[model samples]
Target: MHVSEHIIDIRYAETDQMGVVYHANYVIWLELGRTKLIEDLGLSYIQMEQDGIVSPVLDLQVTYRKAMRYGEKAIVKTWIEAVNPLRVVYGYEILNEKGELCITASTTNILVKKDTFRPVSFKKLYPDWYEIYVREQKNENIN
Candidate 1:
């Protein structure tokens, strides 16, 4: 289902005083995962911005499962959970080096005209990308 995996080497700077990765850092990792997924689909957020289109996060949900320490590696698995004309929902799962799930998250993004900040239909803006997501959603349900 169009899943993309991105690996991140945890750095000391990402940890808290107790050496556990800070909760907020997971949110940043989610962004990285989303970016990787888009790039894997042959699209770039930078290029989208250059084209005057922007996707802004409308909602975010993160569930922490375990604590990860600095120096550990994290693999973030991301995919399209759902997509429609007005919004896209991206899902994520962060796993530690031990293969333990550290966090599960999702983000909802709405496409908009960069200058006008008016909502836009992603299907109309990028048919190919929209089609890919639609296919993935179908595949997910089949499995």
Candidate 2:
């Protein structure tokens, strides 16, 4: 399975009054990781969107483990956890500079026809993309 790691340095602006990274920042970092992973595989999400197809997140889950402070580095590791006909699940791990786990998360996305906003099977309309997914990603283990 393909996996990518992107580094995110925690900036002052990313921290709140409590001196911890804001919750929403994790989501943003997740997106960065995801985008980088796609590009690493020689694909572009923007191109897919321009092709009249869009993959939107259907679900997201984040679990905070340790607090991350400003001026520290974060390692955002992303993996293609699962690839189905209509859905893709991505797994993530956020680690602090101390090499401690800060958060563990995942997001599930589904492709849809941009005009209809209705789900489309990736294997049917985008076989090339599907083939890459099938060959690179392993199915997620629920347990």
Residues forming the 10-long window of minimal summed lDDT in candidate 2:
134-143
lDDT of 2 by residue, 14-115 (tens): 999999999999999999999989998888899899999998999999999999999999999998888888888889999997789999999999999899
- Taking the candidates one at a time, how many backbone clashes does each contain? 0, 0
lDDT of the candidates, in the order given: 0.89, 0.90
lDDT of 1 by residue, 41-74 (tens): 8877898899999999999999999999988999
Clashing pairs in 1: none
Candidate 1: C-alpha RMSD after superposition: 2.5
- Candidate 1: stretches off by over 4 Å: 138-143
Location of the lowest summed lDDT over 10 successive residues in candidate 1: 134-143
TM-scores for the candidates = 0.93, 0.93
